[model samples]
Target chain A: MTDSSVPATALEVRLASRPAGWPTTDNFEIAEAPVPEPGPGQILVRNKAMSVDPYMRGRMSAAKSYVAPFEIGKPLDGGAVGEVVSSNSDDFSTGQQVLHALGWREYAAVDASQATTVADDLPSSAFLGVLGMPGMTAYVGLMDKARFQQGDTVFVSGAAGAVGSLVGQLAKLNGAERVIGSAGSAEKVRLLTERFGFDAAFNYKDAPVGEQLREAAPNGIDVYFDNVGGDHLEAAIGTMNDFGRIAACGAISQYNATEAQPGPRNMFQFVTKRLSMQGFIVNDNGHLKREFFEHVAPLVREGRLIHEETFVDGLRNAPEAFLGVLRGDNTGKMIVNV
Target chain B: MTDSSVPATALEVRLASRPAGWPTTDNFEIAEAPVPEPGPGQILVRNKAMSVDPYMRGRMSAAKSYVAPFEIGKPLDGGAVGEVVSSNSDDFSTGQQVLHALGWREYAAVDASQATTVADDLPSSAFLGVLGMPGMTAYVGLMDKARFQQGDTVFVSGAAGAVGSLVGQLAKLNGAERVIGSAGSAEKVRLLTERFGFDAAFNYKDAPVGEQLREAAPNGIDVYFDNVGGDHLEAAIGTMNDFGRIAACGAISQYNATEAQPGPRNMFQFVTKRLSMQGFIVNDNGHLKREFFEHVAPLVREGRLIHEETFVDGLRNAPEAFLGVLRGDNTGKMIVNV
Candidate 1:
């Protein structure tokens, strides 16, 4: 028998095929591979938890995007929080917890330089969600892209999702006059108003998004965080105030669409209202990492910044977790525990 | 005639009815009104020339826009160049040439503060075209809205129009790496390349805009001055480089559509390329007026900047002139010789 600290084999989830539209279990393959040894400046990590985000849907396709596509027959990589089981680098020691971008496997051999040493006070999984990419996406989209002002009325689509939930909360924390959110389900809408402190929330499926948005934000919104694009974008444009800003983040509603989705018909409002719409990727704003952590880590520790995770147990179920994320089956950050 | 220089009655074009879709001559009424005497801080001017632009289409509609809707049965207003016939303020004197926003009329009683004195070296008509709103629109759209870099590869739609024509030239003068333009007809396309010094020009009517744009800008464009939106906007988004910028100057193609026009289908490119799109009115950027005139006035005086006007004679034909502009009848600035 091997030592309790070391694993002989690691089970990994590999991309079996590039998805045509909506991904299914057949697109992924579970494989057993020999645990890799740490090379020079590398550390062997026993992953505790990993993230499953909507952005992974884009990487599953061969199309060019902000990040490189996940190659078929290769283990998928994403945000992972793990404990160092062995180290070949002087910067890290065994038992230290680190966050790295080498997930979907029980164990990962990652470069020590690439792995960030996270604080031990909060759950290590928090580094994969609220204190990680999802959190940073919210911060950058609101502060930098949307240029959130102190008293601006803000609207956020996909308010139940990881990034959107954080965006509505962050806008409130930053002193927004009113925060409105749109979600797919009634429960998610309730969670937005009751848990995330949104001023108003609505189920987009209940009525036409344009009518609901107008009712919720009667005065018009100064800022809009777009996560579910299509109709939400059209509605946002309809009620945008003069000089309003829109941060185009994700478009999950259109991700699985086989045909080209129709764009906002009222785009002329952009000129009439002098509005600005900008699209950004969090990877392009890495300079804000230190600032994001400094501002958010404290709020997270004090429980002022709430976070929730719907964890699917085991690395073998990582593919299912990702599929769940795309289907909006999981609330907050969808995660997989190894 | 009482006096050739001072007519007893001013012939004016009034908005008889708000246009529903495409406007016709019936939408306007030619009326004769007594020439007004100048009040305090005002001047009575004999208009020599007036402008008819695409933006006027929006004003013709009752819809709220950057500017107030033109009231029915009231004389319409736009850029005009004239000689002051009478003055009640020290800012202007009789027989002095000035530029003001009181067009669609043979004579106007305008506030002296509203009129700007122009040099007599250039034709009075030049003020309504090259040295006026169109010129300022191109400058601000390129420099301020698009945030054009010195070496940016620029793409301009409606390249034969007043704003688009100047945008292509200004981009070249401002040190653009390459400038491409798209126009409706072969003659206008040729004019863009041969006269306006565009690196390449295409007749959008000749082929699919996406395919033409791809061939013209193989390496992708850094900045897009969008005068004609819809298909042009879609094509521009397809071939835009990383961090490309689009200045939404006008959407002339969609301006008269009876129903909601389809927006660019490839807007997802905005996120993938980290692009920014902003819409603005020249009035919002009044702060840039001094800077713009300082830089461009000398260019105009030295003939370093070129301009063209397709003048339709008489106040009675002003409605036809405007209709011609909507039909892409004019090659450059469509003007009315009053």
Candidate 2:
């Protein structure tokens, strides 16, 4: 009782203010607080890592979304890799590495059921990347929702990001005849083809996406997974085959615009080509989760699936990490070490 | 020799010239000739009616589709209702009423396998309305593609036309809590509620679609089957529930526009609502054909499905019928009695 009498403690980072436009480093602030003892069904987790995604930018804004807005003065929540330090539930115990939804913080006291026990063989961080929501999204949208067939041509936008990278690779492994990607930099384009097994990749900034996409997918695309919507979507539409399928996962280009812009003007191409463009939130595709892990885990083990992690030190840098992710600074998965 | 040996001639209507903008009477010409003789698997049908759709406007403009465009100085082929006069294959029998693909003129010779026997109880015109491609398009888009659920709210544009009328009624019968429709005229709005069983209907011109839609679906739309598209789509995006689905059947508003007049301005609504909008061609849902017939035939026979047909007296009026259909002059399906 000697050590316990002093009471436990945890360090937390919270949303201090809502952003006016693009969130700055000032939007977040660190705070010191007492770590409460786990009360029934809850577990105390010492977070080791957390995820930063383009979607998080919307959460920071007051605008509505499928998920609720982040409450000011409360810590933001997203995918996190942590270790259970103390548990009051049988579902979690000390020393067990876990993945949960705590973010921008050093530690968390959360319900045990909220945490998922990732596979022992895979990197626990993978639960935040290829084996988690992003990976499942790619798998479901490409295979099940798109009804993708072998030998079909595939295209992916934001191809160097965690989700898009897997989308490109998985299409190849699934026997797609050709896989193309669009990225922001030469290095990313090269990485897509050389490291990620994409048949072709382009620097969207240098070339008009439509012209570049036509060159990459000479025969036209059968399926497109869109992460960066705007012009990339416009270009993809120009090269889509009759009855092509587009999976709208995210629109990074339109995320931070202070001024509104009409996007991807080629949307009418949908009518001419008789295409199907579906926007889906991945978690609701839960029916495919088990299948995604089964398919992707083995591919990772065989070294066919390659992923990159860009790490930022400390939870205080979480805002910067998110900004970087949205700006496409991260080569692959953007994560923070707490 | 018997008159039958003379190969009784059939008059055919061909597109004399491409229309300047909206088609005029000068664009079509009918010529009488010998009735085509049936080939090994073909049948000669005495065509009762022929339909004209807005999509035919694109076909007339030399644009490509799953089906070939109408070549200038040649026949404009589309869905036609006819009765088999002679059959050269086991699939068809003489004197049986059937539906086949034919051109604008009376009397057509088609492959017997391409013709399907129509129920004697239903009006021949129904084949082009609630029992044909338009009906199947609305049915499959709502039931299968959109995954429309019971108790969901639905919004449909062009709600008095062949496709949209069926779309609204099916939504109501399939357990929609609120089935709202938007049409071009006050009369169409009235018909939508009284005839099509729409929970509510509005004249899009009377008020901005966004405002009307907000008032109509305060709880937000779960499904939107878009035939009008353009402004209606923008409004629908604004009124969509989280994870709402949109089936893009047509965009009549932009169909005849020479230039894409700055597409919808509210693109951010897609990201915020996590809405899914998809376009489809009827052929893509061919697998649903039999099931569609099974589901809709009973509703039709029971008078639960009400269809409208605007018929012209002769092939000479085909051009006027087509122009009228596109201008929203027709209450539902527009056909020619050739």
Candidate 3:
């Protein structure tokens, strides 16, 4: 049985076409579909909020990647938190809030095994940003992938974004000697230093990243958490200290480029400076999820850790939110309030 | 005390001036200096052979690097094996074969503590090549830096060179499923497959490194020992499997370039493929020396590990030998036999 609030039809966004360079609204279609009925061992969810992340851009391409590409004509999916309106399984009851990976829609019919019951302790949307995938990505990329040491000086690119913001803060909290960051705008640069506690921050649009990074990290950076690749990676390589490590989390700057970007010119520094760079995907690192929540959740609950969400009001505007994220329109996490 | 066999004056090669790009013989000066008497705790040695390595090219440049630049008008020093004809300490006796770092000179007054007595079990020049620095570089780079696994496919650039040759042979010995190599000439390619036991070999000059590497390692390479950077490094990145590791040992292709060469254009593969690249200097890895020697020394003695040296006669021709090594004129370890 469906809840009285359940609508007969719901709006879901589907991939209409693959993007060659930057994706536009034309790549997506918002269509009405009947709210799905829960089969045996399934739950029907009325999604309250959903995530619109940078990584979703990769799925829009037809290329093979760590995750499968979004199929044309099918509704796209990602992280979401919603209330279970109907349940065909004993594990979930009506009115229970759960987190699942069936987003980009107003209502979802999810397998009980794929959904996890979440408490109402914090805003349900918090699970989409600070307490979820982005958070774990920040934790693993810095602590594990970069092999961050207590006395290291860190430099993070795209510093005002979800993962970059957390990486800087975590570095500061974990005894980094200094934390420097780079962002695309003056406002984001200020936010990085003033709000996120970055020791120094720069607007990458102002000057060559190499010159700016050199100015900020005169003594050189020991760890680099990379979110925006291309120039930022080259700059970081130039400014890295001997034996420095780089955690290549994402390359948002290159994701939309029509052609492959040239990498750092001074890669010889890798040999001369004895540097190490590693890349990782968050899903492959699920082993760190439990430890991540145990460590970061309480800090977040106590208001010691801060997060921001730029919410778009409707499910139809989810495509807009995603496009905005790609264009760096949002701070912290971009969310769709369905 | 001085050795009776020591001449009144010996010829030594000195750096006359730093080179802008490819160093010429004009950058060097062969000068005669008096054979010095041994001071307290010193040994007088009549040199036998000296190493001319690709890494020496870096030292000839004025730029800051892992090793100090070779000073103008000062006799250059490198790995050399010779007979200790005179000693002023209890640590050494007359006519003892020893290894020390006082190459490019026919006679040396070396500190007894700085010289090591080596066995005559193999050619003494072996101490300067296969049983010495180059061998240790290959060992640490492959086993520790690249983290080679059994059944992994390994690729080595500049496969006919000192370090690259050892890297391929070691990978084969360690149970690599396949070993691929790239060299500059058809002869060297033949040597890689026939002499070095490489599964496949290519002349990088004949075709694009990416195309040739793809043809050779269709399943993709797991480990890459990068001795030639620039195009070779770019190709390796393109052809690497998920979780591939690159040991950035050297960049001979870029050493003589006047401008900093552009690095691999496909660095996003680092993120998509979850790859790791690390660089190292042999001196900094002294902790691994004992283990490397213990593991690899027996292999050399048993004729299981093969090596070749292209020897040039006379100290005055050391400059030509150094220049030749940079031009890929040597098939193996290049040495100046004094």
- Model 1: which residue pairs collide? none
Best by TM-score, which number? Answer: 3
Off by over 4 Å in 1: A1-4, B1-5
Model 3 per-residue lDDT tens digits across residues A24-125: 999999999999888999999999999999999999999999999999999999999999999999999999999999999999999999999886998899
* Order of quality (DockQ): 3, 1, 2
**TM-score ranking, best first:** 3, 1, 2
The two-chain DockQ for each candidate, comma-separated, is 0.79, 0.45, 0.86
State each model's CA lDDT, in order.
0.90, 0.82, 0.92
Better of 1 and 3 by TM-score: 3
Q: In model 2, what is the error at residue B138, expressed in angstroms?
A: 3.1
Fnat per candidate, as a fraction, reads 0.81, 0.40, 0.89
What is the C-alpha local distance difference test score of candidate 3? 0.92
Against the true structure, what is each candidate's TM-score?
0.97, 0.92, 0.98
lDDT of 3 by residue, B1-338 (tens): 45666779889999999999999999999999988888999999999999999999999988889999999999999999999888998999888899999898999999998999987888898898888899999999999999999999999999999888899999999999999999999999999999999999999999899999999999999999999899999999999999999999999999999998887888888999999999998889989988999988899999888887899998888999999999999987998899
